[model samples]
Target chain A: MDVQVYRVPMQRLIQGNGMPQESDHGVAIVGMGIVCSIGDNIVEFKESLKKGVSGITRLADRKGPKLSVDIGAEIKAFSFLDRLYRYSDIPETLLQKARHCAQRSPFAIQASVLSALEAWQDSGMVARENDPERLGVIVAGESTTQNYRYGLHAGFETDPEYLSPRYALQFLDTHQVGVLSEILTIKGEGFVVGGASASGNVGIIKAVQLIQAGIVDTCLVAGVVADLSPIELQGFVNVGAMVRGNEFQTPEQASRPFDEQHAGFVFGQASACVILQSCDVATERNATVRSTILGAAMNLDAVSTTAPSASGEARAMNEALRRGGVCASGVDYLNAHGSSSPLGDATEVEAIKQVFGDHVSKLRVNSTKGLTGHCLYSAGVVELIASVLQMEGEFIHPNKNLENPIDHKLRFSGARFEKARIALAMSNSFGFGGINSSIVFQNAC
Target chain B: MEKENIFSVVKEAIADVLPDVDTEAVSIEQNLKSLGANSIDRTEIVMSSMEKLGIKLPLVSFGGVENIEEMVDILVDA
Candidate 1:
């Protein structure tokens, strides 16, 4: 199948004057909310970080030798199904465990709705009945398999003689955005970003562009995934990406992002949403500003499907910094897309070193994946939330599982910073198909 | 099967399909839909009833059935 590629010219956002007009297309992040294995909300998540609580645990069924490893940072306690039923009268059993899959999922919508509500409340934006069309939603995930069961049921009902309705509903292509739009009553632009891990960053960047283009007044941007499916696990196992044997004894130890003993990335689920509005619009409304998305850039490797080239990541990072009108020296902290995979981590580190060069040594770099696990599409938003917390709390969470650095050239924070005063921070996300996305955020007073 | 045995099987099927549902409220005269049986729930009830009773009835056989009486009648005829 041929994939259609879309690109926004680098010069479009940077024409005429050196700086883009403040009002021309200024976007500000007013509020942020996230739910992950670490915590349900930002406060609880921060508390977990402060206490160094690891959410990873071994899967109960894999206690025997049938499976090689059982450790994972699973969100077993989330009442997502309850939330779904609260919105609609769907039976819990009909929805089943299949509803939690990130693809075509109602769980993603539930998470996004919760986070979006929090963001809107934080932004003090009233949900005016007339302004419904002005609200937009952009969600990111790779596939849409969550509605499989629903489709099958519908099909069986329609063709009871020839086919089972249950089988038909189970086969529909249900994207995360479709479920969210229906549940949230968002009638405006609704899009589901599809990429590898970069889907989240891509969603945020697209949301910013949409708001700036006057397409929507306010945008709910989120990345969500339900990572508990057996097929998802088997896919990673088939690719030799999951850690096995004694390494999976402890969930926290299974994911060692920048450590020399790092094996591979662990799959996990998470969701985060931010309320974004124009800076001038937010100021006029006297809304609280959480963080400013200074600049963002995405690029395609055009090389390989799974492996990201070091040069591609470096170029994307440099482009984002340049677009933000900041130098490498200005970045106080760097959130590396360190998946703990041997090649992926090495490529990200090399990219950082290449872009920052001499200043790389001075950068406070950390990978939150070691704590939360690689949350696929939701990883970018989770990392962004961590960056915001780092700035707000004046502390940088340590990479929990790191014992030894993968390379001497890359610098990793030895201990959590109690007084991190980050001025500008950059978060990097690289996904399969060589898709790379980088965004720069600045602390707003 | 005796009428008592058949009724017990039907109660068990209803209990399995509606775990949280009150089994005592489900009588032969009570409408399944009125007893909180949506289309999906009703299908599950029928499936569970078939599995428990060891009786296979065509789905259309229960189309007009509103209560357990009609369902039981259709199952007996099929």
Candidate 2:
């Protein structure tokens, strides 16, 4: 069979760049809301990125004390109850729902509330006024894995009579999505997407596809880093995929993506939401299109579940660029899936270099995990926010703690620098099961 | 457990499930539905209460429980 490629032609190019857009393929990012270790809001996050302040902390939560790898990116002042009340006018019903699943589900709920609300507020979409069926919600996470790990284990040991029926509802990722849906009163379709660390990318990419397919006029793509329990953290420790010890002076400096001294990824927790609308729906509402999701694609390495595959990753990126009608040379920046794992970082650079050929040096690639740790499902979404910030500011953030470059073949942002306007950018996210995903984004000119 | 003590435990369970609730205002004979718990939430609350009270009330006994009083009776009698 012949290798086939397709394109969604440029509608009317935004004023800034000549990149394609304004066509059926243009899914505009109208709003973004985030709550991460770096900062609770975009203002703080951008400042932290500018200063290169690391959000990785010494594990101090319920799971923090149990792990040998104690360092991670936990929201420092994060208390689910406090955060929920502080950020949102959460109703009594939602609060009741939250209290019901208070055991292992509040982390995603609380973070989603903060992020989704911010996105909604920024979006100016009155769900009550708009067709509720046209507004949808999708969350990406691994929280159900944590729930099964802890809840089921505890349920087995406890007396059935005393078993909280709440545990019965704990296994569904939709519960988290349900909370967001209820809060927004969005009656459209909703579900969860998980592609390991790429889950956020998968979730948002899925949302973009839905809107482009006319499945809905608007969608909220959310990825909340779901590490509410200790078992998931211990899973990483058991697999020897976590950075450990007092080798690094500060816990914040522990994550060093693409650095020669990179040991492994430190887990991080947070949440982010991107409000996407079909270009017409967005502009009709006079929404501010922060950036347009030009194209997205995902694939699996079926070759090796645990081992990273450069060929599979290259294929996914190549497909995404081809779908967006973006040439390898046209990509101005790349937000890498550089999780800092010994093999992961090397393999990703190999993929980028292999896919882009001589255009590798033009792609100013960087990773946010250097400061925030690996945000699990939210990694790609949070990094996409970083990419938008780069385009808006015309500055690419430094890959924090990168004292030495791993390969230096790509234009890795070793230090924060004011750069030319980023007309088109891409973000890569590959997960544990060889799930490689990429999305092409264009700045709204 | 004394009747008063059982009521206290039931109220404690209510507080655990709905931390924002004013337990004093919550009546013992009030329907469990008032606790804002669906069957699952009520089960979780009762199960957690059992964990605290060191009792093992059968889930079958929890069926048709109307209010905090019935739930407390099921656990205290067990």
> B-chain TM-score, every candidate?
0.81, 0.86
In terms of docking quality, how is candidate 2 classified?
Answer: medium
Find the number of clashing residue pairs for candidate 1. 22
User: Which runs of model 1 end up more than 4 angstroms from their true locations?
Assistant: A1-24, A62-65, A81-130, A144-175, B1-77
Q: Relative to the unseen true structure, what is the C-alpha lDDT of residue A346 in candidate 2, on a scale of 0 to 100?
A: 93
Candidate 2 per-residue lDDT over residues A287-398, each given as its tens digit: 8889998789999888545689999999999888877887777788889999889899999988998888997877788898987888988888898888898899888888
Candidate 2 residue spans exceeding 4 A from truth: A1-24, A61-66, A88-104, A126-128, A143-160, A228-231, A238-240, A417-420, B34-37, B72-76
The worst-scoring run of ten residues by lDDT in candidate 2 chain A lies at: A1-10
Model 2 lDDT, full chain set: 0.78
Q: Tell me, by TM-score, which candidate is best.
A: 2
Model 2: which residue pairs collide? A10-A20, A10-A21, A11-A21, A11-A22, A16-A445, A162-B47, A164-B44, A165-B43, A165-B44
Which 10-residue window of candidate 1 chain A scores lowest in summed lDDT?
A: A1-10
Per-prediction DockQ comes to 0.13, 0.65
In model 1, how large is the Cα lDDT of residue A283?
A: 84
How large is the interface RMSD of candidate 2? Answer: 2.2
Task: Give the Cα-based TM-score of candidate 1 against the true structure.
Answer: 0.76
Angstrom error at residue A312, model 2: 2.0
